[model samples]
Target: MVFQNISTNTKLYVRKGNINIEVKKKATGDRIRRSLGLEDTLSNQALALSIQNLIEKDLSINAFDASLDKYIDKCIKVTETPDDLINLTSLWHKYIEFKRKYWSPTTYANSGLVFAKRFSKLKNQDLRFPQKIQQELFENFSLDAVKRSCIQIKAAINWGLQERIISNVKWTIPNKAFEQLLKRQKEENDINPFSNQERDRIIEAFKTDCFAREKGRHSQYYFAIHFWFLTGCRTGELLGLQWQDIKAGYLTFCRVRSQTNVGEVTKNSLKQQHSRKFPINQQLSNLLVSIPKSKDYVFVNKVGKPISFSSLITCWKRVLSCLQIEYKRPYQCRHTFITDCLKTGKLSPSEVAKLVGTSPAMIYKHYLGAPENIDVPEL
Candidate 1:
């Protein structure tokens, strides 16, 4: 076989009757040679030249490792394989870049930031081995973190597959695995709703700003704190509420305002739904009617700005601590509402779910059933 020089640093020659391409890195003075495993025919010569051209292009950008790995990966066959065209980290960055424009700044900060940081732990790992990812998530992260990271990883992988950045394989974590992860998370972070007595005392404390260094008794955010329990709105949704949302004995929830790295961003929908409307009962109506409509927002701070969740959290913690009530997150306000509704036996899980912008499955799974309180009839 005749030896041929394709470029200054690359040459194709025959070794043992098979075509081989050799590359010499000028900067590192390193020599690399790969066998094309083709016979010394005219067709094989053409293929060798083509491969040489690709290597030259990749070497220009100092990406020899990536370039050669992809070529070799394509040539090989195995039961399970690693994709060298893109790794898990690169896929996540590309997927997030493609999705950034579609996501709200808040969504990007809350989800995009967290997922990106956590995924970095699996640096340069191929997406083909989902079990490795599952193991890392379960062993290294908290149960809730593991669940959320798994969800984000799966979403990014699905996007990568659709975009052709990932090779088609059994790369997805199975549904049973996800269900088990969720079960473990639920066990770790079970819903601990405040009892009716505890709920009432907490509300009263917030209303009076009890144990506050600066007292604004029933003046600052009393209505909002009360509203959280009565309507089961999320803290971000309550902060995003406008007076226009209330009309005709119903409140429309279609926006969320939350802090992000950039700043506060407004999303035109609930976290999971596009919108949800909560009916106003007599008690809810009284609370809404009594609050003065001086500001655009139905709930605002003493200085007439949208209430910050951080401030709300500080107040909630203070009230719970001072009142000697067991500490539950402010989010438990929603749990208490859901539990109370389910306990009444009047509202079905689906009805309660719609009112709270959640799923019936979530209601049934987290909230304990009323039968725990009711006496069983003798058979």
Candidate 2:
């Protein structure tokens, strides 16, 4: 059976055992058809008729949506939703499928992959009960890991609720519990930049292959290490650099290369800003001129491919270990540069923040703290 609203240019019918609606705009002469997600049943016919009436009323006022987005969720059956048996691992995968498009490669690498791995541990635990999740997390993981898992699980479950995926599950990890856990973890927000002497030692170690002489691998990233100290750009932004990004008077710091499951992919743009130009001084110009043009990338590994963050960190740790310098991760090169710029009193916090592609607020918050050693002035 078919129901037609001739005056409104609308038709309601069943095709392939599913109810559908077709609307034609009289002014534009465009036809729009959509599946209503309802099985063919006598009771569903009445509901479809009511929806037709609503669409006709909306059309009369020129308020009908041509895309049919407003009606898409009306047919979601609450009784068909996932129940208490749904596990965190399966639900997390579904949530990722819904959200993966909007995330950057860096976000996926840093947060998404870590959350997915942690959530995989709860494959047998039901997602609907907070007690089970809390127990599993605490029993299997460390305190820090449990806290992180709770935060991420809450976020995922909230997203699932908003999307109508798990309608039966209302219980979530409590906020009071999270606050209690947070209180137990001591916060460490102080900046740990390398000293000038240590920085020079690490750079020389990489340049001369002081650590990996037999493998001859550390020397290939010598230019990369030097560039990080000089410019203070993030690892992804530095790795994304191509020969073309170098201008005559300035270098363009744009784009980011982050590693994902498939391979290395470029993320959108630099954080907080689209792109910025770094003025090329004589020192930077000399460094650029010295590097041989082996590939399109200004930096490459021994095999002449773009440098991956993992590979860079592997070389970084080896160099720092060989030099007997305290290990601060590769990002300290950026911190070291920013701290040195501020300590010189040559640039204000705003200037240092601009040079490092960050905000002055961050500089004041994290970088403005007193150094580890400050000698008292003679009065």
Candidate 3:
């Protein structure tokens, strides 16, 4: 290829064999060319003169030879800023904008966006200070919360590096800190399943309470509690249940309803995506048969909508208060069921996992230590 001065203005030409390629010099083009130690001038005549000087110098050297395209690329690299050197916040914003199209609103709020806001002050800082941010988060938040934040931050950083929006660096929580956080979570979340006596008291209280039985009042509260205790379904899964989900002798857990800041949203699949059939016991089957199916849902409030989780918890608290029983989350019904199933010795850990749309590892890890042995001899 041979460089040829075609015009006294901002245009030049390179002849490759019979083809002449025209190259225009814009302000950006001139800057790039200058950064590559080539000619850059205000007027086209001056720029042409500078190019002529370069050509004469190259001829004199008889060693330096490169195509105009290759020289332009080299100039671009010289003038462009490396992605890794961009501010941390700028990279996170790019990541967040990209993720907004793909992630659910609730997930974005709960994970990436939330982490972004928490560390907004450090947005202008470099990603090299990830360890410092991790330490700060661990000190300020609960172990679980910290773990979640770290995961989001790490994911965002990894994505930025992968997309070449930021530099690759070690942005992981230290192994020791992560292990300590896991230990704290395990210690804090130690399963506290209700005993058989406590379970009996709760059921009996709910059944006999006048407030629960009040005509045209929270009557569904009574049945809802019973349904939860009977099925051991997650509160959201039980509330999400529809009349159509009930088959002849089993119920299909295919969806879950969770309340978020905006409103309630129904996920089409259960947590862990482990939707399964839960066989209805004789008592529960009888109870289902007796209830009037006035709405699409198996359980509904007075306004004919699926019962809210808060309402269920309020009813449970009232019942617990009436019975003078100690407070336990409504979720303990699930633990109670798993413990009862394990005590019966009729179902294996894997079987219980299938029944509740959970993992066998979870069942054994949490419930196997104290199986309800009804046959144990009295002291």
Pick by lDDT: which candidate is best?
2
Task: List model 2 lDDT by residue over 1-379, tens digit each.
Answer: 3443445568777899999988865733798888887786533544455456557767878887777666444323312335545566556656665666877655654566556655644534466577877888788888777777777778888887787777677665666776676674342343588989999899888888878856658888889999999999988889898998998999998888876543467865887789978888898898899887865789988788877778778888878887888788788888899999989988999998988899998888677765755567899
Cα lDDT for residue 146, model 3? Answer: 73
**Residue 342 shift from truth in candidate 1, angstroms:** 3.3
lDDT of each: 0.72, 0.74, 0.63
Instruction: Kindly report which residue stretches of model 3 are placed more than 4 angstroms away from their true locations once superposed.
Output: 1-90, 100-106, 121-125, 184-188, 208-218, 370-379
Between prediction 1 and prediction 2, which has the larger TM-score?
A: 2
> Per-residue lDDT tens digits of candidate 3, residues 1-379?
1223333323343332222223333322431222223332111212233333343344356532334544344323322545757544445555766787786645544454445445543322456777677667667777777777667677777887788777657676754677774774463365567777888777666666655756545466667777777889997788888988999988898887887533566777777774778888899898888777866777887677777888778878877777777788888898888888888889999999888888898777677674573357789
Scored by Cα lDDT, where does model 3 land?
0.63
lDDT of 1 by residue, 164-184 (tens): 767663556655666765665
Per-model TM values vs. the true structure = 0.68, 0.69, 0.68
Question: The CA-based lDDT of model 1 is what?
Answer: 0.72
- CA lDDT of 294 in candidate 2? 67
In model 2, the Cα lDDT at residue 60 comes to 75
Would you list the rank order by lDDT, best first? 2, 1, 3
Best by TM-score: 2
